[model samples]
Target chain A: MSRSALGLAGSLGTTLQRELQLAFSSPGRIVNPLMFFVIAVSMFPLGGRMSAEVLGTIAAGVIWVTALLAVMLSMESLFRSDFDDGSLEQLLLSPQPLYFHLQVKVLAHWLVTGLPLVVISPLLGLLLHLPEAGYGPLMLGLLLGTPALSMIAAIGTALTVGLARSGLLLAVLVLPLSIPVLVFGAGLVDTALNGLPLTGVVAVLAALLVLAGTLAPLAIGAALRISVH
Target chain B: MLTVANLGCERDERVLFDHLSFSVANGMLLQIQGANGSGKTTLLRILAGLNSDYTGEVLWRGQNCRQTRQEYQQALFYLGHAPAINRTLTPLQNLRWFCGLQGFSDDAAIHAALQQLGLAGYADIPCHQMSAGQQRRVSLARLSLSAAPLWIMDEPFTALDKQGVAELEARVDAHVTSGGAVILTTHHALQTRHLLTVVNLDALRTESA
Candidate 1:
């Protein structure tokens, strides 16, 4: 409707485009987490050589846990490069509120890092010998849950962005908060395996996504400001 | 029309500067001078709203900068110590995003700004391939591309050679003569059309004591 409003929307897209550019330019940035998710989950199956029954039950836990870690591994770079290169300061000085820009940033991250994890997840499930009934819930759950994981990792990354050697701090901050996503996501497959109704689990995962989408940005915006300061 | 009133700041239990007060208006150039650790960068960051640990207030058109952040930021441009260029990104891409944050960016303006900073024909190359000074120019390209009235720069001439220095000095001069204001910290002696307003942080410290 107005010039500033147009620019506000324009900046968000521009931020997304820039983030995608950064992520794609270094293909390893996107690929590493995917590899980690695959390799680490693969370890679960080979290490124990368990029977199908046992593997099927624990598959969701292993997959959800690995996916959560994959997002965190990819998430640290969300703001670290910007902070190191001083673009974080520029971001802080922008006239538009940081909330929307942060949403766009995490969205780009999800597109690059989270989407790939979702796509190859069934392959990982197959490797783990997941039950046929559980496959649908597993994919559906990750598709819904990983966005919330990405946002949580974004907050953790922003909180420790100012410090060097922040990996442990990132885990300490993110893993605890991620318990809800892990619980609900893994439970979806478990519930489906038992031939339970999917509506309640679906609603909870959707609510977590919505809740994270709205609330995480506020913390992310503040964390970025303090980090830059 | 920016003003600072009785500004004071401390870091690590040491008073870097106290009771510091100055104002920069249209068509004026203010240079902040001090020895190492005198807080020139911190002062600039405070004015730019990057640091909030300071005492006193910064006003943009007589309104508290904190309360009027959006309007104040829209009217201000700041270049700090780091070049702010992503090594993996090309100059064109970097400037596009930088100007986009301020809600204005176009290829024509970005190219012209790069050329102004002696970066002609170098826009497409990734910044990591460029030399340090060239990278700095990529960051400095924001000077011409922005319409904000007040610019606060810290050590903008850090890696520049003679020509780069002269080019930046001329750019700063043109900005001030055209009714824009600039506050900068640099070792390079600047010869501009307007008289320079210099603030020495060491002097402020002594007066406070």
Candidate 2:
């Protein structure tokens, strides 16, 4: 590879490391989201959900909503720290393409927060009394769907970084955007629960990932440009 | 050589400056003096290719800066009013990250630069734990590591003490002595006895008005 290619790779790697370090540094940040996930799943059992049938019927929605909320909870830290401490200005002034940097940031976010949600979905599914056959589809759907959440959440993170109460504002901005991922993800689990072929739902989840991968960076870059002004 | 011709900058309908023309050749230091809120920082941003809302032509080596932004940026190092250091990472980490972005992979040079900035002991310490002056020094350390020919700094001495100010002045002198060009905005009267040109933005604005 040429020198520029090496530099770009290094930039991405360093950014990924920094993001992971920030996410896991204080237990407060990571633990809160994990607790939120557990509590959300537990709610299914509390609301007359002790029966396996009752819990299994609502398992997919519970898991999807919990994963979505976990991602949303962690998304605010994406650009807030950089913006607050003036590192965002340096990023904007860098000689490399800012869009490339933004992409690296989004990827890092998925690796740190979204990847964990995928890894832990099985445990949450168990709590909700998910059927054995639904496990694979749930994890698969989450693996494909969570990155879409990250990409969509980045747009909201960039837009609300300049606002005073950006946390609540971010949820308001991103929840509407995350509906497609929720639909496909939950649809896959629902299909599996009913003994129906999940090929269609899985395909839609993949399509959503591709669509978000293509368009989310442009939206994020535009939002950063507006907010930095 | 760098030249700005017919530069006009505005923010949200308020005209900061208009029809400003300036030129600096090799081995020259241009000090832009202006009062608070006089658009000095805005002018520097326009020069550094970060702000595009302005109307004018900034020519570098006879090439239009706006059209050849990457090429121009490759030759320019801009330090804004805010010290752009990541507080979570150690100074060494921040430097390594920045060097990586600039396509530099030499850690020895980065270490040498940190030492030169009197930050050798604190290189591995996160910037958030350092004092303001020390954090500012980390930003100045880039001046030693970068090979860019043009330096644009906004209030580089704002957080520095007397000793730090002198240290920064020495760095600026050394840079100018090596045939590099510098454009800086400052409230302090720089005591450099080199070939320096002072552009009073307040006077220029009054004349233009």
User: TM-score, each model?
Assistant: 0.97, 0.92
- Candidate 2 TM-score, true structure as reference: 0.92
lDDT of 1 by residue, A25-129 (tens): 999889999999999999987797699888878988999999999999999888988899999899888887788998999999999999999999999898888
Alpha-carbon lDDT, every model: 0.90, 0.83
Candidate 1 residue pairs that clash:
none
Best-performing candidate as measured by TM-score: 1
Runs with alpha carbons beyond 4 Å of true place in candidate 1: A1-6
The sequence of per-residue lDDT tens digits that candidate 2 reaches over residues A70-119 is: 88888887888777776787777677777777888888778767887888
What is the RMSD of candidate 1?
2.0
Docking class of 1: medium
DockQ of 1: 0.55
lDDT of 2 by residue, B1-209 (tens): 89999999888898889998999898899999888988998898888877778888889988888787778777889898778888877888887767766765667777888888888888888788999999999988888778898999999998898999999999899889999999999989897969779887789888977
